[model samples]
Target chain A: MSRFLSVLLHGFWKDLPPFRLVLGLCPALAVTASANNGLGMGMSVTFVLIFSNLVISLLRNVIPNKVRIASYIVIIATLVVIVEMILQAYFFGLSQQLGIYIPLIVVNCIILGRAEAFASRNTPFLSAVDGLSIGLGFTMSLTVVGSIREMLGAGTWFGMSLASAEFEPFAFMIKAPGAFICLGLLLGLMNAFSHWRGENVIQK
Target chain B: MDLVLLAISAIFVNNILLAQYLGNCPFCGVSKKLSTSLGMGAAVIFVATLASIFTWLVYYYLLEPLGLKYMQTLVFILIIASLVQFVEIFLKKFSKPLYNALGIYLPLITTNCAVMGIALLNIKHEFGFWEMVVFSISSAAGFTLAIILFASIRERLFISHVPSFMKGTAIALVTAGIMSLSFMGFSGMVN
Candidate 1:
């Protein structure tokens, strides 16, 4: 029971994608200017991750080992295209908002990394759980960073005006430099927090 | 005149790493040392130029005609991977000196988002043949320019006493943020 739970929840802090593992950072920085954008991008990734992991796990034995990377890339890319098409069909606004980053997810190390590392070795059910947990972890971190950035950069939270009118926002918080600095500080704070508790934090 | 403006824009206004957030993993990973960064940049310049052109051709002539445009992301990635593998083997067999310099970084380019991103952008912008050619090469040149500059900045950062907690990636990312701010100065060059 504990082991099952661990595999599911491990990605929250132990293997947080951007903060600890540092995988899937392109979207972490690119679409995180707003909480809404962060949530949208994270959810898209989660959908791709979960489905790809399941398919990979199911076909683990049948597919040859030598060409598995290529196979995984194809599966992931196809799934991403499906996601993009769906978004374009149903969620036209978000499809436009994410733009290239949607397709770029095909190269995000996290999806391929997990497909290679965890899913290839585990059962379909277990792999699905892992994917869910990790995707949720990614979603949480992105949302937190986005909220902070949006709050500071535009005086809003998830597109809602939080600050009173006439308040000059810290516009820098949404720029490229701001994204880097915010994530850096967040990473440092995570390390500090874990260190104070004597928890081992692996920086990948 | 258009080509010149495109070159300036890709290098500065739309600088691949700082602006689009592509190729960041390698940007941070291989950027610690100046020499290695230079090597990575050169490797990227070569592969990116070639791969972008190749993908552009494939996308337009093949995919457009067959109505397989939806499969572009998959096809482009496979092409980039095979191209890198082909280059690795060809270089190893032919030019020992050039191969030795770029051998290790060839495989890494397969995953660099800049290569993929540029190919896609060229299509999205609906660029013509010469326009695509100029854009791909110059965008890659822009990536090379940003990486080398980042490498130098990181070299100087080694001397300073960074805090214990903010030792590696934390500090590196913060420094990149500062560099990003500086690059913002060029946003108006193209427009």
Candidate 2:
């Protein structure tokens, strides 16, 4: 249906929260040392997010107003546990590399933000679609950032050498500071692109 | 013992804010004034230590044995959020000034990676019950030290003539880079 298509396309450009609003920068910066790591982390968050949105959407009216946030958090956390267990059991290497970040997803503002903003008000099917699209947008952003860092810092893409020893990697690119620089630049570039597009101007 | 090593490392070598980049949302957000940063750091120290303690117990006793270790992250997050809510309500009821100073920062604490990081690190190191307590305390202290120092820097930064492009987060991040580099000096102290 046209409604579903609108939701899916919105995630790519118009309604992309992270690219536009900059809500969840913790995992956006911390765990993005590699493409695989970013992808793995993103997919895990997507899984938790979609399930939580579905559940929250289903129980929206039944939940009491006073305890809604608490109830939402409980639902989100339960889903995180399920995805985390499966990832650890099957994708052990990623499970190890991601390390504490897997658990850190609970604090990722994107998931919680969506739960509060969209899912609580929408139907279950629509909520799931929003979760998937928005999650994919986040995943794309992480991958791009990770790819840039990995390529420049280590002269590799996804752990394979892309540049030779003749090139001296900017060691800072792999460090914590690099995360900020990369993210800031990325945000600026995204802003510049949107301006050039000259379609919809959300504030700077 | 390793506990002592962790304490030293956390304080000087691997501070959560300066080195590991945890708790940076508040670090950058609230570090404009020295006094406020100190207050925020103190609040974080109190909450992070307590949260770490409780999450560790939950992980070791409940989750690990029951083959539900994956649930640790989600459960830990819920625990921290609820704990902050509880702290906020209690403070509002008992003390006005305390609540006002810390009230806004309380909700933000739910996502301050340092709290979650301490819990995860406790699990990763397989720290015993007592060691978790020590690690959490030292880590919290280290976070306080880093933020307060950074706050002092920002106070100075306000007066300094910064470049056009590097005014806000750009300069703060560069300062952190320098801080991280300096902290690297302490690496030899551990080994």
Candidate 3:
């Protein structure tokens, strides 16, 4: 149980991307201006990550070594199509909002990165937990970024009005530039936090 | 003309790299130098335009008529993968200098989101054959422009005083944000 908890915690900070690693920011920045948008995108990605990790873990032995990347892509793309269809059917608006990012998930390095790095080598159960933990970390980062953008860019949270009428939003926060600024600041803050904690641990 | 608008929009207004955030991995990864960025940009122009033509034909002629539209993603990906392989071989044989310049980046073209995004956008907009060709070439040009410009910025950034935490991607993201803001000026120009 302690080992499982350690794995989950490792994903939170040790493997937290955008802040620590900066692996996948294509979808991370483009679709994270609003809370709902971030959550919608993150959950869909979670679905893809979990399913793909499980299947890849199971097929690690059966799949040939020579064409593994190609096989992995096929599996991932299949899941993306399924997720796309399901979103289109049930949540039309969110699907429309996500637009190309949803389909673009097929090429997201995070999913492929995890598949190659963790799942291919780990046991099925471990891979599943890793997916969940990493997915949650991704979701947490997105929500934080999205909330900051939403509050400052549009004076709203998930599109709900948050500020007084007199408050004029900084329109750039909602735009592409704002995505970069927020991400950069968050990364810097995360680094500072880690440094502070590191110093204390060393002293102890 | 609408064709001219499509060209302009792809280049400035709706840049595949900047506005749409497509092909970001290469935009960040291979953009450390200007000359290499230019090379990758040119290769992307060639591949994206060609892929658009091929995917468009495949979608309209083969998939649409055969009622295999649902298989479009699978088929398009296969086409792109094989096309990159062909491009790699052709470049190696004919233009060794260019091939050497591109190096391993050539194979990475298969996964460049801009290529797939443009192909998908062409379908989404239901662009005519000629329009599709124009859009693809122009989009590639836009990608080249943004990437080369970004490379120049990054080259300059190497010598600049960046804070410890914001050394690499942190600074890159900030730069991209500012560029995105600049690109926003082009939005109302087209639509």
The top-ranked prediction according to DockQ is: 1
> Which regions of candidate 1 fall more than 4 Å away from where they truly are?
A202-204
lDDT of 3 by residue, B70-170 (tens): 77777777778778888889989999897887757777787888898888999999999999999999999999999999999999999998877666776
Off by over 4 Å in 2: A1-6, A14-19, A192-204, B65-67, B152-178
Ordered from best to worst lDDT, the candidate numbers read: 1, 3, 2
DockQ measured for candidate 2: 0.39
**CAPRI-style docking class of model 3 based on DockQ:** acceptable
Q: List the residue pairs that clash in candidate 1.
A: none
Worst 10 residues of 2 chain A by lDDT: A195-204
Pick by lDDT: 2 or 3, better one: 3
Q: Which stretches of candidate 3 lie over 4 Å from their true place?
A: A1-3, A199-204
**Which docking band does candidate 2 fall into?**
acceptable
Give a tens-digit lDDT track for model 2, residues A1-204: 999899777777786655564566677778787887888888888888889899999999999989888888788778877777898799999988887778777777788889899999999999999999988887887888889988888889988888977999887888776776677666556656765777555332
Ranking by DockQ: 1, 3, 2
TM-score of chain B for predicted candidate 2: 0.94
Scored against the true structure, residue B8 in model 1 reaches a CA lDDT of: 86
Which of the predicted structures, 1 or 2, would earn the higher TM-score when compared with the native? 1
